[model samples]
Structure formats: structure tokens, C-alpha cells
Target: MSTVEVLASVDIVALRMAPEAQHLQVLLHRREREPHAGQWALPGVIVNGRTPDTSLEAAAERALREKTQVVPCYMEQVGTEGNAFRDPRGWSLSTYYLALLEPGQVVEGEQLAFFDLDSVLARKVLLPFDHNLLVELARERLAAKTVYSSLPLYLLAEKFTVLDALGAVQACLGQAVNNTSLRKRLERLRERGWVRDTGEKNQPRLGRPQQLYQHTPQGGRAFMFERSLLPEGV
Candidate 1:
């Protein structure tokens, strides 16, 4: 009797959050060949070796460089999916990684744009293989993280207003937050000294002048570390 050997593969998915539009965007590359040719799909590479020391992080970095020529600001492992029929060719297990990047960092590819999660979910676009499920999982992870962490900062520019920051958070969660509750959360963040008012007030058309703010270096690191420790499903 001959024994069948299982093959292992690693695939990285980069998720970019845009708060203003309140969307979680995944980078999809257009395929130039058969098996969903001209279709959009996540950037990934196949890993093969006896000792699988190959990290998804490295694969993600390499994919970014090769596809978009950009380095992401944040990366984290989400989970693994292994189904005998997941791949068309053979039995494979794919390890997925999530990444966050600032706007304008990546070179746009054919049909590249940050898409709104709500729109994607509503329209039910056919994703390549099981990639849609992977996206849903990543979206839930990011939305839950943004509430008490500084993950949203990656979506904003160096200097931004409180409203801008709050909008980003709301977008990730796919809903509008109560003004009072949101303000309280911001106050708590301010108390922790994670953010600073930039001292530049912007006068809008029909409202009180709003003060701008920026994330402090100390605050940024603290938020990142705190987020890393958040319990699963947080």
C-alpha cells in the first residue's frame, strides 16, 4: 500500500482599513492566466520545504515588494485553513496573515482600490476560492481591535482631527457610535496620553472650531502592545 503525503502552503492576506469611508479594504491582484483569470484575488505565494521555517510575515513582505513595491506598517497572523479540496491541484493548508498600511503607500495595480466592506458584503461578489471567508474573519478581527486600541492611526495621516479619528473607528466597526460614549472613550485615551491636540483648530462652516490631534510615539507603541494582548474575539 502506498501512503499519500499532505502538502503545506502559506498565503498572506493584507487588509487595509479606511475610516473616513468606514471600509476594510483587501488588496486583490488580477490574474493573468487561467483558473479565475482576470479575476481579483488576494496577493499570496506558495511555500514549499521540508522544514517549514518559512514565515507568512516574510511571504507578505515579499508579496508587497513584488506586487505593489510597499512595506506594510503592521502585520499579524490570523489563522490557518486546511481543506483537502481547498486547492484545485492538491491537498493544501493555507496560513493567513493580516496587514495594515497607510494610504498612498502602495502602488495601485490593475483594478486596485480600497473597497468598502459593507458594499462587498451586500453585493456578494464571488471571491477566489475561500478567500471571502478569510476576509470576513480578518474584518471582524480589525473592527474589534479598533475600539480600545490605536489600530486606526494607521489609516490616518500624521495629523488629523478627533472627528476624523472617530470616523475611522466607526467605519471599521461598520456602524455609527454614540457621540457621548465615543467622546468618553477618547477622554480615556487622552488620559492615557496616547494622543495630543496638535494646537491647530479648524473652523468648519457651521460648528465650533475643532482642535486637531496627533498620536504620540509613546501612545502609538502602547496602543499597539495593548492591542496585541487583547483576548481573541475582542
Candidate 2:
């Protein structure tokens, strides 16, 4: 009987706000070693007996810090993949985690690069080891969860303008969001105590001064969306 070796690993899908690109970007690192050398891939770590007491979350944290020197403020388990052919070395199982990092917080190295959602979806860049599929799944989750949960807050500044909020939502949904509809949603969110006006305004170069808002202490409430809110832009 041929015995297969089973190993466990973790992969992170870190998203960040990219104002310069006017969208969100996913963090990826270039694989320097073999198997998929010179290809962009998600940062991951091998799980072994060395960190016996360390939980999966802790392991992921350690992995991100060690591999990329980036730490996310928000993280949640997405799912797991255990295709026997996934790893060339042996049968490996990877537990995927979705993490969110604020812009200006990440320090990018020569090996690390951020690719915008549109470019990623367009396959303009190369991604190996099923990393592209992982990104798509993570993006879907972000879009679906934003309708209910305040997950997009992680992609915004501490104090943000209405456009900032809307842009974040648009990046997640990958659709053309109606400005008026988004403003109404923000107002409704404030009325529900999910967010609060900060009494500040952002002076834009083109438009008039806009009010700033912040998530309330009891924000990020998870609910359900009754209807499709995003337009078919993509």
C-alpha cells in the first residue's frame, strides 16, 4: 500500500484600499523558489509540530509577519482546500483565511505587490497554486458580506468621507454604485446607529466639501440584503 503524507498549511487573502487605483488591491508575493518560481502567489505557511500550542489564527499571524511583514486588523476563516494534487511535494491541506489591512499600513517589499481587483479578474498578471481562485472567492465574500456586515470599515480610514465609504463598497461589489442610493444607505446606516457623522468635512478638489463619517461603537452589525443593490457594470 502506498502511504500518502498529509500536511496542513494556511493561506491569507489580504485586501487593502488603493485610492491611487481608485479600488481595492490584493496582496501577493513572488515565489522565489521552485515549483512555481517567479510567479505571484498568496503568502502561506507550513503547519508543523513545532508550534503545537499555537492556534491556526496565531499561525497565520506568524506566517504573515514572517513572510511579508504585514499584519491585518481584521481576519476570518474562509474555507479549506485539500486537493491531493495541489502540492507537488505531498498531499497538503490549506486553510484559507480572509484578512483586511488598512492602506498605508502595509510595507511592500520587492517580492510583494498589490494588484487591483479589476486587473486581477482580467488575468493581466500571473497567479499560481490556485491563488487566483482563492482571490475570487474572497472577493465574492467581501461583496456579499458588505451588504449586511460592516466589513468594509476595515478598508476605510478612521474618519472617512461619503465617497470614501462608497468607493470601498463599490470595490467590493465590483459594480457601478448609484451615488444617491449609496448616500441614502449611509443615512439609513446612521439612523440605525451603525455609523455616526464626525462633524467634519473633506474639501475635495472638484466637488464641494463633504461630511465625514465613522463607524459607531456598536457598528459592523451583520444582517441580510433583501434585494440586489449593485448594478450590472462589470
Candidate 3:
């Protein structure tokens, strides 16, 4: 055997709250070309070695911008999957990313459809190129992080109530998070000066006012806790 070429690609799992704010959603678009044409899949792009995309993260950003026009506030590498069978064209590898987004993160016309993660997790929808597995991986990674970190805050508005914070975690985790654990997490953030009470409350039609909290961490870093909110796969 002489040699073979293994191409590289980047896939993104951009997640946010659904339009109705009832569930977590992932961005997907129908493939325009063959090998999986017309099938809805995660936004992805082939890396061009001759270009300025010198890193997988850069290619990931380009894929995100070109496919969804969304610049997320937080994104992380999920993992790499490179095998002769993952793609039809030839041997290839893909480095997938998990992005946490908020409403209004879309800067232009968004052609990507938001699919409820619940549906995907339930196997109601099927994706090609082993993307379903990638989605599963991203889901677990996000849920694990949410258990002990403030990554879910990226899905929340700048100012939110304690309920909002907990809701964000539950939405991302796809499971009810322990309220006491989350409250203590917030308290820890406050102690670390990462978040603070804004001294304001939301005015509702009937319910009493609820205290507000604001994330104050300057950089885009999630404050970590000493323990996990839930055991892995819990």
C-alpha cells in the first residue's frame, strides 16, 4: 500500500433554549451535498489547510459562523472522531465542539433549525456521519459540567433569578438538578465574587418579587465547585 489521505472536519453542537423557553435545543441544517444529502445534521465544515484556520478551534468557529451565523459566548472541544468508516468520501477525522449560546446570539439570517434535545435524545430523530453519537457525547459533557460548574449561565440572560439559574441547569442536564446543590453553588460564586445580588426583583402579575443575581466574572470562565452536583450518568 502506498498512502492514503485522511481529511479533517469540524462539527459544532450549538445549544440554547428553545423559542418557547420550554426546553434545550440544538442547531442543525440539512446537508446540501451527497453522502447524507437532505438529512439534518450538525453544522460542520471541511478544514482548508492552505487557509488561516491553523487550528481546529478556528475551523470550528468558521463552521459556526458560516452555517448558523451565531457567535457563541462559550464553546469547547468535545472530542475527535477519525475513522475510515465515519465518512463516505474517504478516511477522515472530525473534531466536534460544544457551544453554549443564548437568545439573540444569531447575528444574521439563521437557516439552521432548532431541534429539541429531548427529541434527539429520545431517538425520535436520526443523524448521519455518526453525528447522533457526537450529540450524545456533547449532551453528557454538558450535563457533567453543569453538575459542578457554572457553564449553564451562558444560556441565561445577564440578569436572572435563582429560579432562572436552576432552570438553565435542568434544561441543559435534561434532568432535574438539586436545588439545594445549585443554590450552594451560587453562594460559592458569591463568596468568590464571581456573582452578586443585583438588589432587584422581577415584578410579576401575581407572584411575589424574587431576588435577582448577576454573573460578574469578567472573563468567559465558569467558576468550578469542589464537588459534583450529581454523579456521572445520574
Candidate 4:
């Protein structure tokens, strides 16, 4: 019988804006060495060790910095996956995190590129070591969590207009939201303390300036959505 060896690792699902491509893109890195050389995969790292002060979340953050050099505006652990055949090296337990980066937050790396969601999901691009599973899990988690939580705020700029907030949410959902329903939802969110007025204004190229708002630091904990604002399959 083969001996079962366990290893711990972190896989980051990093999302960023790609305006030129006209869609939100996920960051993927091409491997240079063995096991999956020359193939694209999610940026990740092995957990070398743990200390009294270091935790799994900390390990994930460090791995992200060491590999991708991008510090996300917001990050949270979504789930953990372990399968006997998932890793050829051995049995591996991978902690998955969903991370969001603003437009200018990432510095382009040689081995990294922001890929459109469709391209990544189409399976035409090669990925190994269950990396694609991590991406799919992250996508579903983000969409589901955003339905009931204020998690989409992480994708927005420091201060944003209502349209900007809607756009961010729409990007994650990959569908257009009902304007009236969204307006009502935002109003309710504000009343529930999920968002607050920033006392600032955003001047568009043509339209009159609109008031701006920022997410409350602790807003995500304040409420749970009664119904999903997104489409059924999202």
C-alpha cells in the first residue's frame, strides 16, 4: 500500500479589473518548473511552518505576497479541499481564499496575466493540481456570499457612487441587476449600516456630480440578505 503523506498549502483566487478586456479578470501564473511546467495555475505556496503567532490566514497572506506580490484589499478563507489524487506529490490539504484587488493594486509580473472569466472557465487553458477547481469554488463562493453579505465592497474603490457599487456587484455575478431592485437594496443596506455616505462627490465626464459613499468597516456583519439579488444560475 502507498503511504499517505499530508501537506498543507494555500491557493489564492485573486480577482482584478481588466477594463480594456471589458470584464473582470482572475490572475493566473504560468509554472516554470516540474509537476506542471509551462502550464497556468493559480498563484499559491506551501505552508512551510506554523508558530504561536502565525495562523493559516497569515500563511495565505504571506504566500500571496511571496508568489504574486499583490496585496488584496480584502481577503477571506472560503473553504479547504483535500483529496488523495488531487496532488501528485502527496495528499494535500489546501486552504482556499477569495481575494479582491482594485484596478491599480497589482503590479504586472512576467509569469502572470489577468485572464477573462470565460477563458478561464472554458477549459481551453491548461491548469493542473486541481487549480481549476479552486477557481470554480471561489467563483461560486463569491457569487453566493455576495448575495447575502456585503462582500462585494471589497471590489470597489475607497469611495464609490451607487453605480460603481452596482457595477462591482454585477462584475462578480456576471449579470446585469435590476435597477429598481438594486436601488431599493442599496437603500436598505444603508439603513442597516452596511454602507455610509462619505460626504464626497464623483464628477463624471458628462453627468452631474453624484454623492459618494464608502463601505463601513464592520458592515458585513450587520445583515443577511433575504433573497439573492442576482440571477438564478449565478
Best by TM-score: 3
lDDT of 3 by residue, 1-234 (tens): 113777778999988876547478888877888889889999999886665687888899889877888889799998998888888887888899999888545443344688888788777999888888898999999988887788888887778888888888898777787788888888989889988989999986788988899888758878888888885666
Instruction: Give the clash count for model 2.
Output: 0
In candidate 1, how many Å is residue 8 off?
4.1
> What is the overall TM-score of model 4 with all chains considered together?
0.84
Compared with the true structure, what per-residue lDDT tens digits does model 2 show for residues 114-193?
87866776778657767777888888888888865567877777888888878888878776678887787778768887
* Evaluation by lDDT, superior candidate among 2 and 4: 2
TM-score of 1: 0.79
Best by lDDT: 3
Which pairs clash inside model 3? none
Q: Model 1, range 120-161, lDDT digits (tens) per residue?
A: 555466567677777777778777677667776666666777
Q: What is residue 67's positional error in candidate 1, in angstroms? A: 2.2
TM-score, each model?
0.79, 0.86, 0.90, 0.84
Ranking by TM-score: 3, 2, 4, 1
Predictions in order: lDDT: 0.65, 0.77, 0.83, 0.76
lDDT of 4 by residue, 1-234 (tens): 146558778888999766533357888887887778888888877775553227888877876777788888778888999977887777788998988887556557688887776677776665788877788889998877777766777777778778777777777777787877777777787897777887889888999998898777562342467887865775
Please say which candidate is ahead in TM-score: 3 or 4.
Answer: 3
Q: How close is candidate 3 to the true structure, as a TM-score?
A: 0.90
Which consecutive 10 residues in model 4 have the weakest lDDT in total? 215-224
**Model 4, CA-based lDDT:** 0.76
Error of 3 at 178 (Å): 2.6
Candidate 2 positional error at 120, Å: 2.6
